[model samples]
Structure formats: structure tokens, C-alpha cells
Target: MLASVHSEILREKLLLPGETLVVGVSGGNDSSALLHILVALNKNYHYGWKLHAVHLNHCFRGEEARQDAAYAQELCGKLGVTFHLFEFDVPAYMEQTGMGGQEASREIRYGFYRQVAKEQGATKLVLAHHADDQVETILFRFVRGTRMQGLSGMPKRRWLEEGSIELVRPLLHVTRKELESYCEENGLHPREDSSNRSRKYKRNLLRLEVMPLLAEVNERYREHILEAAEAIHQDHAFLERLAIEQLEKVLIVRKPDEIVIDNEPFQNCDVALQRRMITLILDYVSKQTEWSSQHVEAVLHMSGGSRPSAELHLPGQLVVSRVYGRIHFCPKGREERIHMYCYELPVPGKVWIAESEVWVHTNYLERLTDWERLPENEAVFDADRLPGPLFLRNRRPGDRLALFGSGSEKKLKELLIDTKIPRAWRDRLPLLIAGDEVVLVPGVRRSAAAPVDERTKRFLHVRVEFGEDWREVFS
Candidate 1:
């Protein structure tokens, strides 16, 4: 059995040369067996992959948890492989973070694995989640009324954090019973975590109680469950591709944070495609695990908002805003009062806005037609007439600026209040100032003293671009 399973894995994918593989060995039967097989493969075949074992002592089981780490260390020593152990205060962390036991444990364990994998110079972090685990995940998501992505169960590989390390589940096709049988046949010793039998966790109850009853009715229940998960995974991939194509047509993915959805095009899509369209938008905004069906339904119904202006908040801090017959999916924490700064022009060049990446630049001269063509919001000043070392700073309370052409000064606060600039943006907007006087407010207004005149030696060319992805930035 052990040889057959080993042969099956070898038939799948050969490890690339000089590949560094990190295996999570929790001393449990599944993980320990996985480590033993990988170690064997490392030696039996001249596979140039170096093996490193990682164990996270959750500290929930006290000394027994330490014993589990010790067992993993002993196993690694016997196999002559490098071992890493991480101890975490799971209970205290759970209380502090208000996360359930399983959630906390998962977060800590995976976090430790990713960190250790990076430190050990590993490219891939492998886990021993088998077919039975996938089936249980499917059942759990099904009970929660999840979409197809949830029913698809676990994936083979995914990048958790870009450029760090990839998550790989190597034995996903193998069954738990098959792993244990391989360990028994190969004389491989494995530790059994006592928590596995405890019904305190929801997963444990489903595994120990529900799965056994189903298996009693059918001998090949595990195979059937795995087949269902595989089918769902295939279907989910197809839907995801279709959604991505549809999003390219109906969505303006402005940036990683900003996206604009065309409600007119979305409403024209079929009802089945409507759900997928909403899901693609939510995923692009949040990258969350699962969104409820009810929320997707609500977004679909919101295609035609009876209210002229309406906004809705969904899971993962996603905000859907509707305006002028267009629906937009905006990120949360973006709805604060605008902050404006009074900045002094600095050397007639680009200036950076600290609150936002937006940059402002000034050029020497432009055609009269160019000045007129510039948007009223953009500040085009007479560069030569302006003093050097112009400063850019945020707007302050009681700040006053001379109105252009009117030659009358008004308090910045009073103007902002009349314009209905939200109170939060008072301190965030970039204010251009030359010494004691305000020069220009990019995307807002220009100071009177800095207005274009014949005496102006240089015609300023001003434009704004974000710190990142200049091409995708809005004017």
C-alpha cells in the first residue's frame, strides 16, 4: 500500500530541480505520514528538492502540545531533515481577537508556516489535507448555503501573499485511510492528536459523527464525496472564467482599490449571469472566502434603484454606491469628509500630497488655447511670476484665500462649508502656498496672486497622478 501510494504521487508531478519544499508536520497521522513519504522520495529518487519540517505548537493542549512538537522533532531527526517549531498562545489570542478556536488556530498556524517557509528559503509550503478533508469542507459550506466557489472545496495551489510563498496541498487526492495504511505498511510511526475525537469543534462533529454514519450506509462514501467536490470544482472554474470575461466588459477595474460597474450592461445580462456578475464585483473588491446568497440577490435587485441615490454595505467592508444611473462598487473606509491643504508652490515643479499619492506639476509656458483648454479644476498658474520654494500643505481651520478675479478673500472654512465639502476632508486636501499666501488648490481652485498674467515668465502645466499605477489614475 505504501509503495503504491508513493508511486501514485510520483506519477503526478516531478519536483523541479533545486526546489525547496516545506512540509507542515503537526505530528498527526496525516502530516507525519506526508513528511515520511516526502523524505523517502527525496532520497529514493535524486529529486533535488530539500525537505524542511514545520510544526506549530498551538499551546492549547499544554504540555501535550509540547510533546507533539517533540515528536515531530524526533521524527525529523530520524529522517535527518531540518525541522522548525513555532509555539503560539492560542487561548489568549482567541480571547483577544474574538475568533473561534478553529479560526484562531488556522490563522496562527498558516501565518507561522508562511513566515517559517520564507525564512527557510522555501518556495512552496505543502500540507496533508486529503480527500476526506475536502469532502468535509464541502459539507460545511453546503450547510451554510455557499456559492459554487465554496462547494469547490480546497484548491491545489494559491499565492497567499504575493512574492512570499505559495500554498500547496500535495495529498489532496489521497484519502486519510490510505495515508494511515501507508504509514502502517511502511513501519512509519505517527502521532494521534486527542482533539480529533473531541466533538467540541464543528468539523470534528461532522467528521466523527456524520461521516461515519454515511460511510456505514455506503462503503465508498468517501469516493462519492470526493467526486462531488471535483465536479463542483470544475464547474466553479468555468464560472470563474466566464465571470472574469464578463467583468472585463461590464467593469472598469480602475485600480486594486477602485472599480466602476456599468449597471446598464449588467442589467442586460441574463439572470444567471447577474448573480455571477455581482459575485465577481464583490470578489474584486474584497477577495473574501464566501458571500451569502441573500446579499448577491439584493445586489441583483438593486440593478434599478427606485431611490435616485442609494448606498448599500455588504460583507468584507464592501460598499455599493449608486449615482446618475451608474452603480459602483467602492471600498469601505473611503467615505470620509474631504481634507484640503494650503500648499505654497515649490520651484514650479511636481509636488507630492502626503494624504494621497496625487502629484502636482508646473511647466514654463503654454499656448493661450492650452490654458483655456485646461479643466477649471486643475490649477494653471503663471510660473515665472510665482516665488520659488512654494510650499504645499493641508488646509487648516480659519484658513483664508483670495478669490481669483474677485480680489476678495474668503475664509477657506466658509467656502468649503458652502461647497459642502465633507468636514473630514478639511485637513486632507493639498493646498499650494507661496510663503504666507495660498497659491493653488489642485482639483479645486487657484489663488488670485498666482493667476496667469502677461508678466508671468512661465506658464505652469499642472497635472495629478497617483503614487502607484499612474496610467490607471483618474484626473
Candidate 2:
């Protein structure tokens, strides 16, 4: 049993030599067997791991919870491992957070694990989520309207914190029956949670009732489920890579609060890639937005509609808008202009200024237009001379502008004052940003940064319109 368990721990460098680890010991069959196996490996294999056993008393089972924590500490002591125990009121936490009892308990338990690992300077938080847990999770999620991601089940190893801390399940391939046998042979009398016996819990019902029924139907149901889940996980990972590659092809520009993509390139992608890209975009521009398949379908329908312009508001203040062939996304209240914001202005494309209710679009001109008769809402520049990857943003402090045909630069504040632009509207006005220079301040001033000259081969024509008419942006 020890040899079999050792093979799985070394499956993917789950446990390293001379490293600190925090083991979650619930004094249950699975966790107790996990601790025993790890301790045996550490001693026999000369893997100098500094083990710290952590037990969290969730206060759900009252006296039983106390015994669970005590047993965990005793077991750790017998193995010569440092023990740490923490308590949290799972019932009270559920009340304050409005979470279900089981969900709240797991949340508190995992949080306690993270805290202990951090305190102990551990790199990995080890848990005993065995193969049975994976089979049950996959089966549970399948019955609970979960999609592709859910059917894959829990990962053997995943980062608890992106780079700093990882959570590993060394016994992910181990079965509950195998663990129980291991515990008995090792003389570690692990406790069983009384609550697990209650059929009121959906998981317990599935385990006690549904699982047995499935096993009677086919004794190898657990093995079959595990195989299917592993295949789905691999397929999901492949799809993710394909989606990321497709996303880069269509994405025109991205900012801290906004993302702009070309519909032409986006529509060319496979439906699978398209759906994934939308989900990824929504994920990037959200603050814990709980989006679902319904939201993704709505965005698809909105973008594919007959109208040239449309908009939808999703959870987390995310605003999705379609302007002809361009799709835009930013948070709500971004149009208020109180925050410092920047927008990308793609060459031969358009930018909608939500703050000023203005649309600024660009096009490449074959010849220079008459500047004397040009409207204040339009400007022309040498596309060959201007820098690539243009942007439209508000004025910044200490910004200097080099006027057309002028050798010197002028302070933006002084320029705004000279133009009689109101103080309140100074920060609200959109300025065309090219690389590091302020190229154009809409309806106010134009800079000499990319002036069209006699040697100019391509002309960049920029036109601005005032209003929320996205159709005008497309035109």
C-alpha cells in the first residue's frame, strides 16, 4: 500500500525533498491515511519534508468537531509532526455570508488551510481528495447542470495562489476502500464524520443510494467515471489553447477597463472558439462576475442581430456593445469621465467617447484635403509619419503640445485656457494619443507630431461626431 501510494505522490513532483508542507488532517479515513502514507514516505525515502499538520474545527458537529481536532493532533504527534489546530464558527459564518451550510463549511476549512500554510511558510497545502471524491464530484456536477468544465472534476494539483502557494492532492488516484485498508494495517484508527452518514445531504444521498445502485448496475462504475473525467479534462485544456490563439487574432485593442475587437475576424473563428473567447473576455473585464451560458448566448444573439448597433449590461457593471463590425466592452459609469481613462484608436477604425457622447473614426486618404476649409470636427495627418497603435485619451497633467508648424511645445493647461475651453470640461475632452505625444485635442487644437508633408505617401483622415449614434462610427 505504501509503495502504491508513493508512486502517485511522485506522479508529477507533488511532493519535493527538503520542502515545507501543510497537511490538512480531518482525522477521517481519507485524510488520516494520507498523513500516514506521507510520514512513512518522508522517513523511508529520505525526503526531508518539514510537515505541519493542520486541523480546522468548523464547529458544525459541536463535540464531534472537538474530537476530530484532538485526534488529528494526536496522530500528528505520534508521527513526530508539528500540529496546528484552528476553529471557525461555520454556522455563524454561513449566516453572515448567506452561504449554505456545506458550502460555508468547506470555504472556512480551505481558508484555514491557506492561513496555516502561510504561517508555516509552506509551499504546498496537501489534502486527501481521493478518486472517490473525484467520481462523486463529476457525477454530482453532471446532475447539477454543470457543463464541460465541471465534468472534469477536481485537479490533482492547482495553485491556491497563482505563484506563491499550491494545493496538491497526492492521493487523487487512491480509493476510499484502499485508504481504509491502509489505515487498518497501519493501526491508525481514523474517525468517521457523523454528518456524512446523514442522507439529507445531496452528496451523501448520491454516495449511499445512487452510487451503490450504479455499482450494482456495473461494479466498475467508479473506474469508468474516472476515465471519462480524465479524458474530458485533457480535451478542455486543448480547447482553451485553441481559444486563446483565436482571441489574439480578433482582438484590436485592450485597456484596463475596456476591450475592442473586430467582428469580421472574430466571426471567422469556430463556434467553439468564439464562445470561449467571449467567456474569456467577460472574465477579464469583471470583478467576480458569475456569468453563465445564458449570458454568453445573449451576447452572441445581441452581436448577431439585424441592428447595426446594440448594447447589453451584464453583472458586475460590464457593458457589451456592438457598433457595426466592432464589439466594445467596458464597465458601467465609465462614461462619467471622473476616472482617468484611455481608449485605443485603431487606424481606419473608430472610438466612441462615452463621456462626451462623441465618435471619432479614422480612414486613410489618397490625397490631402483642403485644411483651410476643413471643419473643426475633422483633421488630416500623414499616416506614414504617425506612430502605430494610436490611442484616444483625456489630457494628463504637465502635458506638452507641439503646435502645427511651430518649433516649440506648449503646456496643455495653457493651450486649453487660450482656446477658452471651460475648466470643468478640460479633463472630460478626448485627446488623440499617439505613442507619447498628444496628436489631437478634439475641436480644440492639432499637434505637428504627424503633419502631412510633400513626401507623405499615405494620408490619415480623422473625423469626429457628437452624439451616441454608433452607426455614424461605422460610416
Candidate 3:
């Protein structure tokens, strides 16, 4: 078993020389076997790996949990390896996040693992997830409705924190039965969790009831499921690469708060690529793996058709909007129509707009230097020719502006439409209002009322700084 496991690890290239490795141990058969195998491989084969064992107590099983942590510590001590133990309040976490017992436990457990790996300076974090886990995951995702990405199951090796920490599952090719047999052969007494026998959890019910029933129908159901997952993983990887290429072409703007895509280019892609691109965009913005096939379908539905405008509220507080020839995907409150308010702009002062989360800084300059070379987000206006105290706010009804270089005055709404601004974003766009007149619309058109050519003695330099992407509000 050790020789085969070592060969599998080598084939997978899970470890490199002179690197620190953190192994997650739960005092269960699978993890015990993993720890023992890794230690043996390092000692006999000189794998040159600095190994550290980490155990997280979920604080659910009371005495049994403490016993498991103790056993893990003693086992590591006997093997002359370092041990780290941490405890978490899984129930409290579940209550706080409104998650179930299983999800909260898993989230806290992995968070603890990552924290330990970082503290230990480990480059790779190892888990004992075997082929059985992969099969279970695939079945679980399928039963709950998933896309190809979720059906692909767990990966063998992946970056947990891009470029910082990696996660490796060396036992992915090994079965639970094999690991149990190896533990017995090595005389490793592993603790069994009683919760695994409880049928309250869906996974337990699937493993105890559904899996056996399926096995009765087909003796090799588990093996077949694992094979299917592997195939889907390969196909998903290929499609994901193609989707990324297509995304770069159609993606108009990508920011932490939102992502904009050209409707024509996105609509022209194959259905598979379109679905993948939508999923990629959601995943990138949310930074969470909770998006489902339903969310993807909702986005696709909203972006489809020749409808002038449509909007759909999705999971994770995300809102997908399709306006004219553009698709906007952003957080719920970030979606264009933010609350409108007017605040006095103080000269030589900075004001942070809570509604838009933007900072408007105004400075008085004696004279303008290279006025035509100002940045896109900055504008200089004649201070002496101003109508009254300047006020900054969103576009209001009946707002009109005499666009620069255009003699005729146009309504703010008409100007925005002519400028090709998404209809949904017109209300959220910031404007510098002087008394009843519009002076400057940052990153867009500037009012012809405050043109500064040469007679200006004092100039007001106003700059808009957005905490997130300025393009979301301006472009």
C-alpha cells in the first residue's frame, strides 16, 4: 500500500523538494492512514518534505471530539512530527451564517486549515479526500442540480489562495476501503465519528441508503460515478479555457463590484460558451462557489432576446441587468439606480458620498496649467463665473446641460442616451450641479456653461474618486 501510494503521489507531482507540507488529520481512518503513509515515505524514501499535522475540533461531539484531538496529538508525538490543534464553535457559526451544520463545519474547518498552513509556512495543504468522497460529491451535486463544473467533483491539486497556498489530495485515486485496510495493516487505531452513522445529514442518508440501493442495481455504481466525474473534469477544463478566451473578447469592464460585457459578442458565442462565461463572471465577482445552474440560467435568460431592458436578482445579492446592447452584472445595491441625494460641495474640501461611496475633492487653483490635459475623472471650472454654491448629486428630473462644443442645450437624460450610457446607469451617474444648472459630468460630457479658456483667474479643480470601479458609474 505504501509503495503504491508513493507511486501515485510521484505521478501526480503533489510535492516538491525542500517544501513544508501541512496535513489535515481528523483521527479518522482515512487521515490516520495518510499521516502514516506520508511519514513513512519521507523517512524511508527521503522525500525531503517538512511535514506538519493539523487537527481541527468542530466542538460538536463533546467528549468524543476532545478524545479525537488528543489521539491526533499523541499519534503525531509518537511519529516524532509536529502537531497543531484548534477548536471551533460550529453551532455558533451556523447560527451566525444561517447555514446548516454540515456547511458551517466544513467552512470553519477549511478556514482553520488555511490559517494553520499560513502560520506554519507550508506551501501545500494536504487532505485525505479519497475516491469515495469524490463519488459522493458528484452524486450530491447531481441530486441538488449542478452544472458541469460542480459535476467535475473535487480536484486532485488546486490553489487554495492563488499563488500563495496550494491544496493537494494525494489519496484521490485510493478508495475508502483501501485506506481502512491499510490502517488495519499498519496497526493504526483510528477513532470513528458517530455522526457518520446519523441519517439526519443528506450525505449520510445518501451513503447509507441511496448508495446501497444503487449498488444493488449496478454492482460497480461507485466506480462508474468516479469515472464519470473524471471525464467531466477533463471536459470542463477544456471548455473553461475556451470560455476564458471568449470572455476576454466580450468583457467590457471587470471590477470588484461588477462586470460588463458587450451583448452582441456574448450573444454570438455558442450556448455552452455563453453559459460558461456567465458562470465565470459570477464566480469572479462573488469569490464564492455557491452559484448554481439556476443562477446561470437566470443570467442567460435576462441577457437573451431583443428586449430593451431587463433585470434579474440572483443569489449572493447579485443583480444581472441587460440594457440595450450591454449586460451588467453587479451586486444588488450597486446596480445602477442608487439612492439620489444632493450635498453641498465645499471648495478646497473633500466630501465622501455615502450613497454612491465616492469621494469628491475640490481644490482652488490660482491658474490652470495645461487645462486640456486633465485626467478623465478630473475637471477644472471657472470659479468666478459659477452661478452659486456647488452641489453634487445624481441626475434629477428636468436636468439640462449645454454640452461642451454644442451650442444647443440638451436634457441630461437625452445626453446620456446619445452618449451611449446604459439606461440603467443614468440615475446613478454623478453630476456637479451649480444652483439649478449642471456644470460637469465626470468621465462624460462637461457643461458648456463653465468653459475656462484664458480669462479665468481662479479655477476650481474637482476630482471624483470611486472606492471601486469608476467605470461602473461613468462609463
In the range 1-475, model 3's lDDT, one tens digit per residue, is 8888788888988887778999999999999999999999899878788888989899899999999999999999988889989998888787887777776777777787788788888899989999889888888888988899989898898877778889999898898999999988989999999999999989999999998899899989888888888898899999999999999999888876789898998889999999999989998876544677888888888788677778887755678888768888888776546777888999999998887668999998877778767876788888888887799999888988887776988888887777767766666667898878898877676777766877887888999887655554444
- Give per-model TM-scores: 0.76, 0.64, 0.81
Off by over 4 Å in 3: 255-258, 287-290, 305-385, 389-430, 444-468, 472-475
**Local distance difference test, candidate 2:** 0.81
**TM-score: model 1 vs. ground truth:** 0.76
CA-RMSD of model 3:
4.5
Task: State the lDDT of candidate 1 residue by residue for 3-115, as single tens digits.
Answer: 66455556645245578988889998899888888887778776778888889988888888888899899999998889988888999998996776776787788787778
Query: Which candidate should be chosen as best, given TM-score against the real structure?
Result: 3
Report the error of model 1 at residue 27, Å: 0.5
Q: Local distance difference test, per candidate?
A: 0.73, 0.81, 0.85
Candidate 1 residue 186 Cα shift, in angstroms, is 3.1
In model 3, the number of clashes is 0
Model 1, residue 74: C-alpha shift (Å):
0.9
> Candidate 2 on 4-27: residue-level lDDT in tens?
878877778888898899988999
Evaluate model 2: give its TM-score: 0.64
State candidate 3's TM-score: 0.81
